[model samples]
Target: MNTIAHSTPVAIASARTPSFSPWRCYWLEAKHELLRLLRTPSFVLPTLLFPPLFYVLFGVVLAGGRSGGDMGRYLLATYGVFGIMGAALFGFGVSVAVERERGFLTLKRALPMPPGAYLLAKMAMAMVFAAIISLILAVIAVSLAKVSLQPAQWALLFAINVLGVLPFCALGLCIGAWVSGSAAPAVVNILYLPMAFLSGLWLPLQILPAIFAKIAPVWPAYHLGQVALKVVDRDGGGSLALHLAVLGVVTVAFFVLARARLSRSQ
Candidate 1:
């Protein structure tokens, strides 16, 4: 009775003590997360290689010598947008799903890491990959395709390309939160190819069926393509404000959904 009484207060005190600082815990996890991605070639290789190959096959070889300057510029812009989507969807989304299934997320929760840092690190990495891929495509466009844009144009195009990934990143998070690893790639492909095709990333809007052209504006890919087209060609036909607004809305919506889904899963 005396020993039990003596230990009770200590147990109570320890229970009241904080286990870990959220910030420190998150920082450590974020570093590990980044390292995990770096070590995974399945994630890195497709992001680095696919865009340029798509450009070579579709933009150059298939496009042949027929497209005018505006059409050529549009192809580059759209393909760059396509590349950004690949990183955000496959690289981030599938990885998150796999991590969740593998108990990594559960481990982080057990450690009580700061929620924001883990997500911020993922977003940061996605944006970094998007920027790097965009640069590579830009170089390819300039070198092989002889595509040229003024400095301001280049800056605008790059900005749009980077910003365009955010909403998709959020969407990827939602997918990651919901799907299993085996199903994730299939879901991503179903979403990716359709969005790319319908949104005119595979080809110009003019070349697409009229119905698709009419509905393209509703898709995030279309807005991204619109912003990219505006920058690459220095055209201002589409309302930049509208594109930005739609992307912002989609990002917020997907993030909210992802958060809810994650909480439920926990």
Candidate 2:
């Protein structure tokens, strides 16, 4: 009884341990998150490879002759968007659902770390992956596809791809909060692939039946693809403000919904 009594305080004190510094704490959290995901081959391999492979096949190798450059530039933007969406959705959605199912989220809450650090870390990881995907696509476009663009256009497209992960991250968070670990992957794919195709990421919306073009705006990926396409001057014509507004609303709305679901879970 004496030993048990003595150890209890130490455990409590450890649970309430002081962080070294707030900024350092956040950095460590994010660093570890990146490391953890990097070690997961299932996530790292597909997230990094699929986009570039598809870009190579459909965007470059299949470019046929004269229109190769246009196809390369256009798909570079769209596939970059596709790559980031996977990073955000899988990085957050499947992981969050699994962690929650295993009570890891609750355990984190019980720790002395900062609350936002967990989320911020995931977001940072997704952004890093997004930047990487964009870079790889850019390199492929330059070397293999023979695609060229103004330096400003390159930088702008990179910015759009990196920043574009946000709304998808929010959407993923919502999925993670609502679904079971086993179901999250299936749910994300159901939403991910169809949205990508419907948004004209795989094929131009013009050739799709007219109905798809009419409803394309309903999907956030379409808006993102448009903004990215606009950077290359291939977008199907619309106000840039409108795309930004839809993306902004999506980011805010899904985040709010996820937060509500998470809070209730607690």
Best by TM-score: 2
TM-score for each predicted model, relative to the true structure: 0.84, 0.92
Give the TM-score (vs. native) of candidate 2: 0.92
Q: Which residue segments of model 2 deviate by more than 4 Å?
A: 1-19
Local distance difference test values of all predictions, in order: 0.81, 0.94
lDDT of 2 by residue, 1-266 (tens): 35554568878898799747879878999999999999999999999999999999988878853474788888888999999999999999999999999999999999888899999999999999999999999999999988899999999999998899999999999999999999999999999999999999987898799999999999999999999999998899999999999999999999999999999999
The C-alpha RMSD in Å for every predicted model, in order, reads 6.5, 5.9
Task: After the best TM-score superposition of candidate 1, give how far the Cα of residue 248 lies from its true spot, in angstroms.
Answer: 0.6
Point out the worst 10-residue segment of candidate 2 by lDDT: 1-10
Clashes of each: 0, 0
Clashing pairs in 1: none
